[model samples]
Target: MNLLNMDAENRVVLNVGGIRHETYKATLKKIPATRLSRLTEALANYDPVLNEYFFDRHPGVFAQVLNYYRTGKLHYPTDVCGPLFEEELEFWGLDANQVEPCCWMTYTQGRGKFGRVSVTRRGAHVTATYGDMPGAHRFEWVNPNS
Candidate 1:
């Protein structure tokens, strides 16, 4: 149904980056000034084949963003890269500060003539150490520019 005639309690189907999500219209309208809220308001009619509003976005990240709307809590997902997650949150008009501390960790091991470099993270902080050089280390985060 079109938004003009949609029921307040009706569930809306969203095909977000090929992933399907069914949420209450009221829930989707909870956050004003957000893309989701604007999308809900712009729902002129549902697609015939998909029968949902289609949006081009990373489906994986959208799941976490959806949860924020559903629960009023935001958790940085470990599966998604921090930089990418931050960009998605920005697009969704979400505050990055809502993220819980140390909610994610990433690891990268590099091996070469220099032996090996091990890197790990706790939230935005990253600690790196080299196997060849004793006590060799450095710390960094995803959003260095910001």
Candidate 2:
């Protein structure tokens, strides 16, 4: 998600639901310039209208997830970016690697890292969970007409 913030060191804040989800940033460093340039070239041709609000310095990470969301595409080659996701897994480092085909949202309230929140899918929508919370929510891809 695109956000406005003053960045420093290894951190950024995601503004979700009006509250700043102030937390650490997992943005990749040391992006290999050559491969990134190729990805950029391929991306410009695809975006006829330039609508994606890319949050990465280059589109590698965002593009990986967006294509997964947009057209159910996967394994689009992260040759230079393989290290990026590995970096994210560093904190998830000790935690047991849960089976994939799951949804997880992790954030923080203060100094502590909140573990990934559980998620469930219902039809075309997704629901995230916080244990024992009274209310639960899901966001369906909005289609004015189905």
Candidate 3:
């Protein structure tokens, strides 16, 4: 095989929610025991015709997961709900504890609330609720410095 063809053979293509992401196979192998690293074992998700693996998951979140494989740092995506992100992490055999310290608070927000009064920051909306409350309250914070 030519140099370019040989190089392409070492890359992997992941189709997450119809979004295509390509990366080196060695990158996925960096994190042993993860779903990505074990892609060969999961024949059900592979598409031979397309030469890619399909995942019916959030594409935006999958970008972050792929990023974790490329870079050893895992940063929380603010656009995704905390619980949803945690679920994705679990499915990929990643530990939430590995989340960077800067994102820990946002990553854990609204987690373990169990109907207690808790505030969740999601983009422009801040949702707060009281235990067994009738209605949820939404508040937006304005930066004084800005």
Candidate 4:
């Protein structure tokens, strides 16, 4: 079994999903995998707040993004997802064909831009807002200087 010491504010683990991934800084881990799953399932099932943040989005994409926060990496960027997956490729409705792909990043995070990727649920499309920009979104794919 994997060991996770979540005995403090920020929990840390030496392995996850048997992947053995490490974190930049070790945290006091407390929540075990089962507890984490229970919490996640409960949050996903009952959190209207999260729904407002990403309501009507694909479950898979939402899960992927959530996984990013957990693992500190985003495996599915627009460029990556575009070439790797076609429309109707993923079980969730996170189609890379809906719009352009985009990527962005902050100081702590590394860069892997993939352009703007958007998807529609019913009649409206998930959009991003930038100050006076035509469409400022999260996945804008800003290339970092080498």
Each model's TM-score, in the order given?
Answer: 0.59, 0.21, 0.76, 0.21
Where does candidate 4 stray beyond 4 Å? 1-54, 77-146
TM-score-better candidate, 2 vs 3? 3
Deviation in Å, model 4, residue 115 alpha carbon = 11
Candidate 3 lDDT over 1-146, as tens digits, reads 79999899999999999999999999999999998898893599998888999999889988989998898999899887677888889988998899988888877664543235667776665666654434555445644444
Candidate 4: residue 122 lDDT (0-100): 33
Please identify model 1 stretches exceeding 4 Å from their true place. 1-9, 40-49, 102-146
Candidate 3 error regions (>4 Å): 110-146
Candidate 3 deviates by what RMSD? Answer: 10.6
- lDDT for each residue of candidate 2 in 103-138, tens digit (9 for 90 to 100): 222211111222235777656556665433344333
Q: What Cα-based lDDT does every candidate model obtain?
A: 0.70, 0.33, 0.82, 0.33
- Prediction 4 global C-alpha lDDT: 0.33
Model 4 residue 134 CA deviation (Å) reads 34
Q: Give me the candidate number with maximum lDDT.
A: 3
- Count of backbone clashes, every candidate in sequence: 0, 0, 0, 19
How far out, in Å, is residue 84 in model 4?
A: 12
Candidate 3 residue 144 C-alpha distance from true site, Å: 50
Estimate the overall C-alpha local distance difference test score of candidate 3: 0.82
Q: Between candidates 1 and 4, which one is better according to lDDT?
A: 1
